[model samples]
Target: MICIRLFQWGIFVALSFVGCKSEPQNQDQKSIEKGIERIDVTEHYVSDSYHKRHDGFDWVAVSVKHHGDESLWVSVRSRADQKKPTCTYDTKAFRIDKNTYESTYDGKRIRFEFFPTSLTISTENPDDSNMLYFFCNGGATLAGHYGKIDGELDTQQIDLTTFSKVLNLQGIGFNVSSIEKDNKNTLTIFTFGLENRDYNETFTIEGQVVIDAEVEDLNSDGSPELFVYTQSVGSGSYGNIFAFSVNAKKSMSQVYFPPTSENPKINSGYRGHDAFTIVENTLSQRFPIYKEGDTNASPTGGTRQVSYTLVEGEAMRQLKVLDITEY
Candidate 1:
């Protein structure tokens, strides 16, 4: 199940919910809103060829746990090419996040010359709009960290088709929000896609690109690691897992297949989540976490269990799974 946190103005409802049950809720709410600052958000994405291959939906991504208030943040650009990702950050009309700081844009290009009307704004835009957008929302939710861009901004007509990018998924229509390089060559990716989102065999994540992916020397190895997420494109739910490699020299051989157990169903094919990293810098936790069923139970359900780990050189990887279900 996905999680949701509501926000009134700039303050989180939870902060008020439990904090002010018997107290004056509206007063606390007004005080928080009156803090008088600004609020901005940024959402990034990452995916692979398989995510964009079949389903049009490449991957899915969402902002860090926020109050989902009237304010909104729209992703503008995250092209597949790592060398040239143009996220609209500096524009006054756009809201952005920093990789290391809460106040600054994460050093990306944000073209918001097409300010106000450039975005359909709430009324929720398109279900597939991946670009990050900012909403001042009449400036009522602006927090301290929130600040305006550097220069003039306006609405300039550009091809809407070029605004598209592909992504990947986990648990089907799922997408990860954060993928921090762990202490090891492994990755810790947090899924912040949608709420109550589930993966049925019929859903897929496609046409999304992961941008600004990097790793830190959490272990002080001098070399930064690369972390990535997996999003399915065709015929199934997207954003299934996260994956990694020690380096170019130690890449593992992998495979994908339909279930063929003695009591397998007829047309049921299992979707795979990416390799998970249970620990760090140990080259450990390497395996597949999946749910499967035979063709006979295709639409109704499938069989799923703890599969085997990826047999690495001289070592065996372990699998860590929280839950498994099929549709």
Candidate 2:
């Protein structure tokens, strides 16, 4: 779609090296809403540095996709061997200009400048390039000019073993990464730029896989909330959410999400495959309803959409059902 949607929300293993297929932007899509500007770019680029090595080429590739209304999904990787990559980076870069985006990590700013047929990567301060060394090995740096690739980039070439996302608002940020090991996924979230470092936390999610995560100021409190969506591996694909709210930009607290099974009013015919997004200030969840005798592949019942509002509870914040509609 790379522009962050109405509310800004929110990686793979590279095993192979392939190019990206450029996709056309939809002209009818709105580029700005409520003064929120978005950069529209969905393309791939590659570097020729690989040709320098005869034993194993230093191949670097980049993929940029429209994320929401104001962000781009940017992924960069460098491979010296077909079995493993030397450098890998995956995160959301927020739009700074019509064709430029930037993301801050490890106290450094990495910028992406886009052109008609090329992309240039650089650091805000040239000396800050050293911070990027954390993701690379063997003296490989992600900062360089890459040429646009005309073909589709085989995403499978990048390692999908780990998923990562970076979200920021009001000077608070989070780096969320999930790594799967032995059928269990360990979700690690590192908070940065927080007024109180003690608020940062890491979690271990067993048996389920993280599908996606999002950040938003759901209560208009000026601080953001983190929403992590996950699904169990198997035929069911049952979805679950892990969320936290920033407390006055100092500490963080978990936001309770009522299970569908406990909420009898909305649980009828519920059977996984659910998707979620924030609409205005509410959390919106939509899923296909399954009637009796309905196979997992098909659901005769119409779709059910539910919206939840963030409210203060005695102990913690909770997402309370605001409304539900089916059609």
Candidate 3:
């Protein structure tokens, strides 16, 4: 009886160990199956194997990342014989669906269609071949299908620093790019597809970094307004806004944004880390209010939200605070 009891205890221990090990294996298998069905926008891919080995065949490589919720930053490179690249393109692709994207470069509309395992670049109108010839050389074109790669791409193969976004509304488009140059930030704003507006401006920003941008028609006018938000590069993260309104659908004029320092009531207990967004036709700014004994990292006080309405000021159209709330 003692021997039988000892044998039963040993079998129980063995079974318990097997159950624990099999549970993790089952979970890992489930995770792999889930990954197979997942459509991750941020992926790296390369051309087919034939192009990679042959000298005459041109090879293309691409990498993509999420620019915003509705757009992707795509970087592409094509080369032959391991020599200088024949084509290089880096820009934003606005999403049309879950797996489709579109962009306009040099006045031509390019489409990017993604499948489960491959990506294809083409134009909506096959007759418009100028864009393909213009972006590539040596008879190599940026239009092709590519296969997905599993791991990280080589760092030297793609542009990782530059920030770009393309915003379009009504028939007008704005291509905004930002780069760090000479210890300061530089922004270039270019307007396209406008009949009477040739709005291309560059600004040198000091002590701040461009965070995000939005486009809206505030007053229900036919034309739209562009707002660029910036934040200081430090612990404070003080925010600023640069805005431009389309004038009668022909030209654009700068819209003034009031500084917080001038408004004593709103400026009290303000220590930056602000967030701005457009709710309907009104612009809203929200930040944490700090009490007298609060620290920069931790603010014990509640949040302060300021709502502004667009109005014609003495000098130009500016944002006038309509109400302020604390909660």
Candidate 4:
């Protein structure tokens, strides 16, 4: 029965990481109030050429090192690469035992478990049969994935918020659902079909809510594009940017650099604090612009640097700003 429900969800995630190591240490005092003293784990494997044109998929970079610096990073995907169905790993395949760590290649499998507060990743791929789950709580990053299609198995989840902490990219299929009341935010954008069985669309942003979301490919032509970031209640540091394009079907009706009542630049509505990137394949942003009665706690109107370029079969795959600098 699917390996007994994946061994009862791996023993309820190892007893919820042993009841979160009995709580109290508060994640080592929030990593010593951010002057982090320790937190290590590094493993990377990216067999280039942009993951061999997407479906051969293979990239894994989980380097969450702290005291030794280089704070956060997380990304995963593997269907076996590095030359034909070959997979590899060392360092005892990421040791760590009791706190969990596992590995398997060829048929693909990966796991890294650690919990006092959070950090998790689990993967599987019986040759694209799929299964994945990722978690991180230094602020937020959660994910889930499952697959099957025609025979039925599908599952998906994604929740993001990282305060610009960084989480890079990968295949990232869509499947987000959301709804918020008073603040008015609605988002339901699904789309599955490796065998066909899912489709949805509903994306609203009436008054803002939705701290962040990411998925990129930004015109790499390998599919993957959905970037949402919102904010607005009292509008302290104005923010809002939405970009969608999941190969099309009028999904979210295509929005990139939207928000216009005439001249709303800087990812749609300039203000302050904004930084997004998707290098090489292009899609960059940097914000901070105010001056018409400035306020964002004192901003005079200076930073701005946009750059986009996606332009696919019209109707809505348009994002061609190409450059707009100002230091």
Estimate TM-scores for all models.
0.26, 0.62, 0.59, 0.26
Model 3 vs. true fold: TM: 0.59
The most accurate candidate by TM-score is 2
Sorted by lDDT (best first), the order is 2, 3, 4, 1
Q: Which stretches of model 2 miss by more than 4 angstroms?
A: 1-161
**Model 1, residue 119: C-alpha shift (Å):** 14
Residues 1-327, model 2: lDDT tens digits: 111134343221121122222232333322322134332357667776533434554566777776666777676655423655665667667888877788777567888776665666778888886665555555656666566777664443444545666677778877777766565678888787767674556677776776567788999998899898887677777778898999889878889999875789899999887767777788888888999999998999999989999999998999999999999
Which sections of candidate 4 miss by over 4 Å? 1-61, 65-73, 77-190, 193-242, 245-252, 259-272, 275-327
Worst 10 residues of 1 by lDDT: 13-22
Candidate maximizing lDDT: 2
lDDT value, candidate 3, whole model: 0.64
| lDDT for each residue of candidate 3 in 158-211, tens digit (9 for 90 to 100) | 323234556778788876767675577888898887779669999888888766
lDDT digits (tens) for residues 232-257 of candidate 1: 33344233333332222222211222
Model 1 residue 240 distance off true place after TM-score fit, in angstroms = 6.6
Clashes of 4: 0
lDDT of 4: 0.41
Better of 2 and 4 by lDDT: 2
